[model samples]
Target: MIYLDNNATTRIDDAVLDAMLPFLKEEYGNASSLQHKLGRTAHQAIEKSRSSIANYFGASSKEIYFTSGATESINMVLRGIFERYQSIGKHIITTKSEHKAVLTTLEILTKKGAEITYLPLDNQGNINLSDLENSIRPETILVCLMQANNETGVIHPLAKIAEIISSKDVLLFSDTTQAIGKYAFDYAKSGIDICCFSAHKLHGPKGIGGLYIKRKTRPIQIEPLITGGKQENSLRGGTYNTPSIVGMGKAFELISLKYQEQTAELRNYFENRILQEIEDTAVHASHADRLCNTTNILFKHVKSAELMPKLINIAVSSGSACVSGDRDPSHVLTAMGIAAEDALCSLRFSLSKFITKEELDVAIEDIKSAVQKIRKDSPIWQLYKSGVL
Candidate 1:
């Protein structure tokens, strides 16, 4: 299938897999067991991987903490911080368009007596900086915003946001899962206090990801979410998944801007073709600065549920894969002022560095034809054409 669901997950790169093979078989040893040669080798590999990942984001190795994935990292950081600093301030701020990982975790925090302020988005899937600045109070201890949205790929001005909250006592945390490989971020220069990302989104194995807790002069403090063994400096406690960690390290090393630029060109061509060739089509967040490899489109009169099934050769999604099973329309789209009916008609097409121009061309034709077929059978289309609605 021509996969356009890279935002959900990407295929593991061949080199990353090769780097992981030895760790999976012969080099299998707990990273915490350092007395034996096998254990020492595993420990060294884990540290090397950690250093590589940390350097990519302009951070030190000591600042990086590995977790199962972004979801786990999100829960760890959010809950840890809430529990540790609740006495100082129990209030946090985040946007309405965050992934279910953040939203659901925050929901649990609310029951624990933590107050949450959800910032609203405009029609173009952007938050007003003024609203964000005005919302921060002395009681607010943290601001959780994502660098890039998973559905529409709309980018937030994170550096600007960081500057706004730099003087405040509150810390800035971002879910950088979607933006890590595709966009540029420097933990030191960006002024972000904490962030988390998954390796699967960057062509690495699925079970590995990391959290970056900046080591400042005062240092950010948080309690451990898991406590049994001291694996990640007592911040995260568990036996390391050595193979996946190695693969993630290799994935970080392989990230190239050249490949990302090529993918962006292909994505732009796909969106331009779809909008030019299809009737009554609109691109979500087209006016906003968004990730180069993503385009969320709304095919008026054609429901995505019906349209997606018709294009069996293409792998796209109605919204975030985490909540794709839910029957409700996309929360991201609806929060941006799109009606639920229109949200249901929207589809997100995310490309990866591996996708070629030839594949994108084929997918675009298939999408156009499928949309036409769906619209032809749609009663809404007929009514609009006949001016009867």
Candidate 2:
């Protein structure tokens, strides 16, 4: 299959897999059991991986903490912060288009008295800085936002946002899950207090990710979500998934801006072809700065549910893979002022560095054919063609 859903997850890189093989086999020692030579070797490997990941983000090794994935990292950050600092303030600010991990966690926090302010997005899928500035109350403890959107690939201006909240006591937290490998991000310069991302999105092994908690003069503190062991500076517990951690480190080390640019070029070619060859099609968030590898297209009058099944050889998504099973329209699209019906007609195609121009061409032709066939049978398309309601 022609996979265009890299934002959901990427195929593991051969190098990353090779790096992980030793750990999965003979090097199977618990990182925390430091009394034995095997355990010491495992611990050293984990630390080395941590250092590599930290260096990629311009952060200190001490600031990085491993977790199962971005979802778990997000839960640990949101819930841990609320539990520890609810007495200082219970209010948190985030965008309405955040991944379900953040939204659903915030939902539970609400029951425990956390106040959430969901910032609105404009037609271009961007938040007004003024709206963010005005929403910060004295009780607001954190400003939670994602660096780049998973569905539309719309990017939030982190440096500007950091400047806005810099003077305020409120901490800035970002979900950098979709941004890390595809985009250039400097954790040290961004002034964000915390951020999270998963390795699977970057051609690394699944089930491994990291969270960065900034070390400031007056450091931020949060309760541990997983408690029991001394792992991760007591911030997280459990034996490390050594193979996955090593693979994630290799993945981070292998990130190349040149490759990302090439992928972006391919993505643009795909988008341009879809818009030019297919009538009544539009690209979502076209007005905003987006990740280089993503494009969400609106197949006007054609439902994605219908179009998707026809393009069986291509792997694309209507929205975030985490919520693909839900019957509702994409929350990200709807929040950007897209009508529910129009939102349902959109599809997200995210490219990986591994995809070639030849493959993209084939996928594009298949998409064009499938969309045309689906529209031929669509009553909505017929009404539009006749200029009738």
Q: Estimate the Cα RMSD of every predicted model relative to the unseen true structure.
A: 0.9, 0.8
Estimate, for each residue in 1-389, the C-alpha lDDT of model 1 and write its tens digit.
99999999999999999999999899998888889999999999999999999989898899999999999999988998899888789999998899999999999999999999999999999999999999999889999999999999999999999999998888999999999878665667999999998999999999889998899898888888889887788888888999999999999999888887888888899988898999889999999999988999999888888888889899999999999988899999999999999999999999998898899889888988888887778888999889996
- Please count the clashing residue pairs in each candidate, in the order shown: 0, 0
Q: Name model 1 segments beyond 4 Å from true.
A: none
Output the lDDT of residue 153, model 2: 95
Worst 10 residues of 2 by lDDT: 181-190
Error of 1 at 25 (Å): 1.1
Best-fitting candidate, scored by lDDT: 2
| Pairs with steric clashes in candidate 1 | none
